[model samples]
Target: MSASLREEMELIEKHEEILGERAELLEQMESRREQLKLQRKQQVKEGEAARRRNATLLQDLQKIEDCLRGRQLPPPTILALETKYWASVEESIPAWEHFLQGKGPHPTDGPGQPSRRAKQQLKTHKETTKKTTNDQGLPPRPKPRTAR
Candidate 1:
């Protein structure tokens, strides 16, 4: 071939190589996008399932709260078990004494305290119970007196 023709052929070969690389890269990008889409769909499904489970748990908790509201006292067995559990916990953790007294960090004020969301939920529950009690024309439950 002539010199000019040979140079043009080399240029064309370089262009073809570049085009092939670009096409491969595009295919890879498309594959990655598909994978990401599938992952996002799976995450959404998992999130929905988790939300369903949480709702069911909340309903169960509400039922338990309703049952407890009607009863003035816990069963004797439960009371004894609770007393023993607390005694055991106190014995197991020496710092619990300091926490109970005014000497150290309060249990309800530190990391062990409920989260903001939990506090809000408790407030909502209290409001709901008050509303229900008022609607039913029943006397509101008295707050438990705490020991000094």
Candidate 2:
């Protein structure tokens, strides 16, 4: 073959290789664009769901506030229960105060403060201790002075 013709064939081959590489790179760019589009759609869906949940929560809170505003006082049943609960608590205060002041027998099982079971045990112990002292002919212990 002639020298110029050989040089033209080599140039044509180089051009074909460059076109192939360009096509491959364009394909990769198109794929990446599609992936980003899907990600954006997913994010939009999640944001809409979050907004819907927030609106629902706000509506529930508003309903609760409206209900509270409609009633100045609780029902009679609730009031009675609350009164009874407070009376019971008031009745127990003297014993709790004595226990807290270290004048009564301490609970044996727990640390720092007493649990409900420990308080019950303490009450039982106080009763038994009183009975035993009296039965043994020991003089009754002096009562601890109270602020009340």
- Top-scoring candidate (lDDT): 2
**Which is the leading candidate under TM-score?**
1
Question: What does candidate 1's lDDT look like per residue over 37-114, in tens digits?
Answer: 999999999999999999999999999999989889979999999999999887757565776664665444557787
Question: After superposing candidate 2, which stretches have Cα over 4 Å from the reference?
Answer: 1-7, 73-148
Clashing pairs for predicted structure model 2, backbone only: none
- Each model's lDDT comes to 0.87, 0.88
Please list the residue runs of candidate 1 whose C-alpha ends up more than 4 Å from where it truly belongs after superposition. 74-148
Error of 2 at 7 (Å): 4.6
Q: Candidate 1 overall Cα lDDT vs. reference? A: 0.87
TM-scores of all models?
0.48, 0.44
Q: What is the C-alpha RMSD of each candidate to the true structure, in Å?
A: 27.2, 15.5
